[model samples]
Target: MSAQHAAPAAQPLRPARAPTGSGAIGFVGPVLAVLTIALGLVLVRDALAVAGVISGDGWVVTVLDAMNGQTRTGWALAGGIVAALLGLWLIVVALRRRRRKALWLRKAAGVGIRPRDVARLARVAADDVDGVLDAKVTAGRRNVNVDVRTTGDPYTRDRVREVVTARLAALAKPPKVSVRARPSSSTSGGMT
Candidate 1:
């Protein structure tokens, strides 16, 4: 009887999109809202000045006068209304960002894990295996690498590899595991 092997499935090309850093939108959202509001203020100011309520100064001065000017009241009322609306929009954007950042901070506070945790877990697991005399594990942001000093026995090295792989899987994200069986004298050789 012939054994049949299944072909591997093709992987997706694009990485899945994860949520951006918390409060990222908060930083951007307010700036955008302010710009939009400024634009609205400009348009309204121009309209009012054309109608002869205020002098056709730049948008900023025109809008300012429209709000505070008493006698010359052409588009003053409309400009004030538009400015108020823009202010409200800016406030809303700021508030939304603050809320999102608060929520993200709360969540991150509870789920924090450090790279040291990865190294500790790997060392413990490798040391517990039968053939491994000692183990050193280093962890990076998203991965870990381990070095195992063995007692010159293939079985012990294999056991160390297996245990380390299993423990890392349980405690940390799956790390790339490499197993090296070194001569005892190599330990005296300065690690380069």
Candidate 2:
């Protein structure tokens, strides 16, 4: 007896928004530098106190007060917890600084498409339609709106819609398409 074979199923494609190639977050360096400077200053201050160059009374008093009583206050605990959480968040963000690949990386990189680029491409696609005279296109994260000035042909708008929808559909995540059309004076002259 022979075994039966089955065809493979197709999966939906993810959107064309690819990851940006930039390394760790933009703010990570600045934030880390600030923290490092603050820590260094504290270290220096403590060293000077140990060496008797400066009196430790101020910090010592503060630490004593905190340990003795101030911590019991609701506001103090809340503030300390908030500060600790922020520090932890900063550290985590620094460690995994790589941003998600969904963003367009760079102009030279050419790995991903920007909204403006999408709009320009949509305009070109719309213009390619036979009766479309001019196409103004705007592309957003989830939408592409096209305003078409077309030859007086009654089907011009529908044709533009078809062409643009087909073109943008080539993208991984196709944005919602909206098309509006008006007859242009160019209709009397010919395709512009």
Using lDDT, give the best candidate's number. 2
Clash count, one per candidate: 2, 3
TM-score against native, each model: 0.37, 0.53
Error of 1 at 170 (Å): 2.5
| Model 2, residue pairs in steric clash | 15-173, 18-101, 19-101
Once fitted onto the true fold, the runs of candidate 2 whose alpha carbons sit more than 4 angstroms away are 1-24, 55-67, 91-112, 127-157, 165-192
Candidate 1 local lDDT, residue 154? 54
What are the per-residue Cα lDDT tens digits for candidate 2 across 80-186? 99999988887777677464443243332335666777888889999898988888998886788998887678787777778887876656667788888777874
**Candidate 1 residues 1-192, lDDT tens each?**
334666668975653233334454557676787888989988888778777987766676655777684575658678989989976876665556332111111223233345667678778988787666778887754556777776666576667767777765543236576666663556545331
